[model samples]
Target: MTHTTASTTAFAPITRAACIGGGVIGGGWIARFLLAGIDVKVFDPHPDAQRIVGEVLANAERAYGLLTSVPLPPRGRLTFCATLEEAVRDAEWVQESVPERLDLKQRVLGEIDATCPAQALIGSSTSGLLPSELQTTLTHPERLFVAHPYNPVYLLPLVEIVGGRATAPATIARAKAVLDAIGMKGVVIAREIEAFVGDRLLEALWREALWLIKDDICDVETLDDVIRYSFGLRWAQMGLFQTYRIAGGEAGMRHFLAQFGPCLQWPWTKLTDVVDLDDALVEKIGAQSDEQAAGLSIRELERIRDENLVGILQALKTGHGDRGWGAGKLLGDFEARLAAQVAPAPALDITAPLELVETRVSPAWVDYNGHMTEHRYLQVFGDTTDALLRLIGVDIAYVQAGHSYYTVETHLRHLDEGKLGEELRSTCQIIAVDDKRLHVFYRLFAGPERREIATAEQMMLHVDTKAGRASPSPEPVMARLRPIALAHARLEPPAGAGGIPARRKETAAA
Candidate 1:
């Protein structure tokens, strides 16, 4: 596999990005760029640009909130430039998302070429426009190319990177590096091609869809459902070729080809078919679509689409079943990193107690019981413990390298209930420590009031990930944990909370 790494010596910090339009695609480009922590400057003639951009940002924020594994970094500063020149002046990358007009694209490219630095990379979010056509009038055509992304750019992972004949390999590499840094998947096209890969496939599917609707074989809604229920699921994990490979069975590609080759000669579709946008067909499709989504507004539909996309993509990353197209490779990379840092058992230190506290509960944390569930409380506390351990230098990489700690046993007492949106804190202290085991006590408290909410005592063991068994803590790590545990042991334990609720004699008697 060819891998591209960011050049540490010549890396240019992409702090600012410039967008030439503020329409749907432009706005989405701005959101993704900014949400990935790049400052954005946008220029558009429309008077409603500000309001429209604001709405796009709001939607991007909502979609980002659903991602739990990796947190979205802080949003970059957004600015509305009075002129195109001003927007591109200091930008490392400039994205053109204007209307699909060759003249307009040429004009914009010319203006950008005259203003922006020659070294700066320029990308166009055009679905089918060739880079040659778009950069025809540019003096530095090599710097400009197509970076076609799907609608809702913030959620979609694919970005087709197509370069014209004059396009430099270094520029393509640089663009791919930036996109990869922001968690986007970039596929490089060796030479300029019309429609690119995704668009060509989409065009073919769209042609068939139009034919289906026009012939009255299926309505717009039904055609969409056919894709969503069938090919969409298959496409999510594997593309057509790999999916067909599996269907081919043990016979492999040759056998599969022989079986399906006959279908190629069949009149499956009209290669030169075109559907005129007549009033009757338009009304039929529009009415049916409106009826299918009766009560949903545009925003509601967008939310639904984004939610489903996120769920599918996240599921693919988890490698749940039938390893997805490229998700397995990415997940493998992530898991390798995780394995290198996680310890098999928990290790204790006396000098510094684990930073534990009752966590502030969000609306998403509340269960039907109205109080924080037992599992959630453990989750919050566990996260808090992990954070503290990380601060003390025992991180995922540390644990995965066979030099970390794990919880062997846990004892808890629920003294009070926590309501949604309530502020909570947790306190942890190391009570005992040895070469293999570390015992600690944790107290969860309501913030400010310091009222005890829950108490937990846990025994942690030192573990070696490679051996998959308990082991002695490494000498360096042990030295660090010992001092911290000693210091924590000297501090007075908080008053009020007692043993586990079930073990309380009075409660049991009552």
Candidate 2:
């Protein structure tokens, strides 16, 4: 069971990627690459390929919008190529997601290996076919390997990397590294196998479930309910072995195994056998599944599934205090990566406001009135405040040292409405400052005109967190803050700095 752990810390990101198919999995790969800011070239023979990919991309965009507050990278160019050669020619990575037939896969790999850059790594999205078989027709087969991903590949992050006999070790390493850069967990299986790891487990369970249906023990809906309500929840977070370890209780794995070892010998599962999937069984399963769906379209059901996954992943993110747990930890790490991509704070421009944050309004930020909601305005202003803090050296390390600026008061005025998908930028102005107190004003501008949509005057206090009292900020923080404050002192006071007109307040209520 040799493997590469999903703890790849350092690697170069793929600059360009190519997808050989534009179906569900291929589109997912394209969405992932594009969302990570890598341009993609795609070749799919389907007549409606663009529309299909567009729908998947739309769902992915919606899911990602609700998934995290970390500002995503700007989407890269999506090009639909007329031929596979054109798609793969300059790509740094090429993904083959054609139908799972071995002959088709070999033909595609041959074409890709012949056309793509020699260094390009090719990942086949084969659920079970051995990569060794898929690579047979390629001259440079070293780059071809099984990189199986779960369905709705945009959301679920696991990619099982199974290398063929001809595949180079470097290919496996580089593949995992690339997957990590895109916020996916890729584990390299040391030895190539028939179905790989994830699907093998799924097939075993699926087989038993089918037998139960064939024997009239339970229907498809009941089986799904049993899983979703029970171990499905545990498996999402802790996985199999770890959950069983807890069942061991005081003694752990050794005791738990001793208690349940006898159960393994019993005929509880039909793993070595499978029920015939005849027409009657198919009809029964299909009928039950239709009932379970309750007439929801595939797209509608997919949205529901994606929303549930996002909620679960987010919960995992905050599970262990603020650090995160399981895949949630990976998400937190990915978000940290995204946050790093924020342009570094520039030198303070004291004569005018410092533009602190630039972003687009997320679809979720809008209200039923079709404008950005009330609290989201504060979130943007708060982001500007955070940026200003970083500029002044009040970063995570500084706060962990027992002192931070705590906002004490705020005055906000919304001058214009914000709409979904509107481009936004926020600027910060230093109104006043001292060793222990800082006052700043923020202006939020929307669209190309940079019209002011909102403004907030905030008073913040530097505090010794451990001592529970006001404290002077460290000298490093003050060093950066002093110059900006000194330069801003020469400017005329802002017109509405401390005062709000009654008419303006009345307008806000309206």
Candidate 3:
């Protein structure tokens, strides 16, 4: 565990992380950090720790790759440490996810607190344990706080940040920034409470579920159906209170509370009653749960769950108004941040079409006809435009500085159909550029043969986004664009690039 290595010496800003306890949560932290291009050092004595980390990383890789269109940072290194000291040796952030035993957590936290630099923050993955208890044995308790991330921590964005009695305000702020950098939404609990917030609601629902099953009111499968098919959809975006507020209709929350307030005293629920967990009850629940899953392995079930969550979340991101709002807005903001972080293209060969975006058709893009849907082609073109802008020095900062290109007109030609899993690459050829307008063409190709699948011709106008009107682009951006445009003019213009295709020959003949 104490072996020295050369790679440990090159830690940069937010570049390295330490995960102690390589169980589900710990391994998930590793995946999140590693995928964010932060090197991760993991410590766990369990024999299967490496295998667990690998499996979790694989799941995370697949899920995150499909989660966003923004380019991600390069994958970081992952190292397994045999002992806790080595794990903490150079990590800027240390996450302790040991079992919930207070004494054990304290022992581990104390060791981390002693070994890690004072500037290095330590976060506990305790579900309900107070930070007061966790820091009791630590020398630098102010730097330790509760950072409760949801299950499958790599995919879920919520992280409840609870600072204890001895926790410093600065420590909480630092924790929030770190969580945000890793693409997580961190909610800082203003006050410490058992079970935090999310878990408390979840525990209540779980208690009710247990009672339901115990009383034979419904089986596990039915319970799941009632949830996922019912309020579960609402809960994802609007959550409980907001959903109920809408239920109030014209009267709003006041009327809703008045109408349903009396239900609080009704004995319709058995939350106060304790269910006895006899062997027979346990066996019955286990068999029913197994029956619900059929014969699918845990990994298979996890993959399905991750895919469904990703699809729902992505849909939520594109929706607003009546559907509701919450994490989706946050996700959109994160995408913007990711877009901003992308480095400009190293160099461009303007003599040819600028290769900007190379991505495969996502499974979500497949339609009932088993081909890439029509709208997705537009989405890919949009991504290609974003990359084109990035290549010519029009980055997030430039856009935020009160000028950006807005696509004003688009004409797409579907030369050939694209199927699911087909690798699609979009290359941009600048047709013309002026201070206020950009005329561009993009060619979409499929697979290694690079067969032309589609082409998009668009006219983009420089706009003051705040004013919602066209404006001249800045001189610096214009300077970069003009040179690239001049260079691209030398190449032959793409055939059928700028015009919508006329009605097919058969339709005309008919």
TM-score of each: 0.79, 0.88, 0.80
Write model 2 residue lDDT over 380-417, tens digit each, in one string. 78777767786777765667778889998889998899
Q: After the best TM-score superposition of candidate 1, give how far the Cα of residue 438 lies from its true spot, in angstroms.
A: 5.1
RMSD of each: 7.0, 6.3, 7.1
Off by over 4 Å in 3: 1-13, 321-324, 345-382, 397-475, 490-510
Q: Which tens-of-lDDT digit does each residue in 289-395 have in candidate 3?
A: 99999999998898898898888878888887634247776777766766666666556566788877777665557679998889878878888887777766777
Worst 10 residues of 3 by lDDT: 1-10
Task: Show model 1 residue runs off by greater than 4 Å.
Answer: 1-13, 320-325, 328-383, 408-434, 437-460, 495-510
Best by lDDT: 2
Candidate order, lDDT descending: 2, 3, 1
Q: Report the CA-based lDDT of candidate 2 relative to the real structure.
A: 0.83
Error of 1 at 270 (Å): 2.6
> Given candidate 3, what's the lDDT at residue 65?
54
